[model samples]
Target chain A: MKKRLYIVLFGLAVLIPLGLLSGSPAWGEWDGAYYKKILGFIPKGIQNAKSLNAPLSDYTLGGTNSITGYYLSAFVGIAILFVLFFVLMKIFKARGKSEQSA
Target chain B: MHIPDGYLSPATVVATYAVVAPLWVYGFKKLKASLDEETLPLIGALSAMSFVIMMFNIPIPGGTSGHAVGAALISILFNPWIGFISVSLVLLIQAVVFGDGGISTLAANALSMAFVGSFVGYYSFMMCKKYRAAPFFAGWIALVSSSVLTSIFLGIQPIFWTLDGKPLYFPFGLKVTFVALVGSHMLFFGVVEGIFTALVYSFIKKRQKVVVA
Candidate 1:
């Protein structure tokens, strides 16, 4: 199961660049400009949205090719998820051990 | 669907967070109980799959695009709560590090794409367990269900929060949101999710049996 799962993950990661083929954003995930163009004004809240400056905003690194940025994002995201689960497992294991000893 | 920050009203944000907080707590407990040495790698891999799968955007005939959530595979393999928590973790990473989603709307996004998607897929699979195509049905219905909830969240903004005839947040009404978001999912992305879930589920199960044999 683990082996097959990783194989699928790797296969999809290899095709990650295909995700960038669509220039159009997902519906309702558009920028403030979209609202301005459609509704003739950007929604007040959206226009003044307190958006965080994400490190890899839209999965792009500054001054890098899009495909490179995408591959890097995939690797980083997968790594982060694996690390997170690994850490959580360790924490849970430690807690279980402590409780058993107690 | 990843609802960006500021797409929802403050009231909606607070309401979604309030509703999801207890679910997160309960789901976390369930996740911890389910996790151990053997299941760790599997769960981790599945969660990573969910994250990476979302990167594969399938553009529909319309201008926009969507992708499969992979919630059904995890939910059917383990349980809905585990699926929920795992996918929620994925969404958190997307929101914080990648900005694919919004921090303020994390609860809303999690509720729709994680909690709703997982539970819906799980129950649907259970109902149709006798059928060979159960995973496909589960994945299709789960994604469509998530899209429905997302449309509702976005659809209600204009009706309630408008100021001087201008929408304060998402401008689309239920009619438009349903037609665009839900319609697209039902037609395009839902099928993609169904195929993905069925293919992966059968592969894993088939390989596991061979290994045991």
Candidate 2:
């Protein structure tokens, strides 16, 4: 099962660049300009909504190299998720040991 | 569907977080219970797969494109709560680091894409387990269910939160939002999700003896 899972993950990771083929945005998840053009005005809340400056916003880094940035982003995301899960597993294990001793 | 920041009202944000908080807690407990040495790599890999799958935005005929959330594949393999928690983690990363989704709309997005998608997929797969196409249908049903919830969340904004005839948040009514979001998912993304799930599930099942935990 583990081997199979890795195979699938590696296969998908190799094909991750194919994700960038679509320049079109999903329906309703459009820019504020879209609302201005369609409804004649951007919704007040949407226009004024607070957005944090994400480090890797839109999966692009500082450089114009989007393909490399995308690959890097995928690697970063997977690493972070694994680190978090492992950390949680450690905490749970510590708790279980403490409970057994108690 | 990831609802960006400012697409929902403040009241909606608060309400969604309030609803999601307890479920998150419960889901985490479920995740911990399932997490062991044997399952760690599998869960992590599957979650990573879910994240990578969403990055694939396939273009359809209508000048709009969307990707399949791999919630059903996880839910059918493990369970719904596991699926929910894993995808929620994926959404958090997308929101905070990638900015693909908005922080304010995390709960709403999780509820729609993670919770609804998982349960709908799990039940659908179980109901049709006798058939070879169960995984395909599970993925299809999950995505459609997620689109419906997203439509409801977005559609209600215009109905209740308009000021001086202008919607304070999302501007479309249920009719338009449902027709566009749900209709698109059914026509384009749903099939893609179904095929992906079916293909992956079959590939993995063919090779290994999966002992469902």
TM-score of each: 0.97, 0.96
Q: For residues A4-87, write the lDDT of model 1, one tens digit per residue.
A: 888988898999999899888899899987877887999999988898888999999999999999999999999999899888
True contacts kept of each: 0.84, 0.83
- Provide the global lDDT of candidate 2 against the true structure: 0.92
lDDT by residue (tens digit), candidate 1, B1-213:
899999999999999999999999999888778888789888988999999999988888879989999999899988899999999999999999999889999999999999999999999999999999999999999999999999999999999999999999999999999999999999999999999999999998977988899
Chain A TM-scores, per candidate, are: 0.92, 0.91
lDDT of 1 at B82: 92
Per-candidate DockQ vs. reference: 0.83, 0.86
Best by DockQ: 2
Give the alpha carbon lDDT tens digit for every residue of A1-102 in model 2. Answer: 678888889999999999999989998889899998998999999999899889998888997688898899999999999998898899988888999999
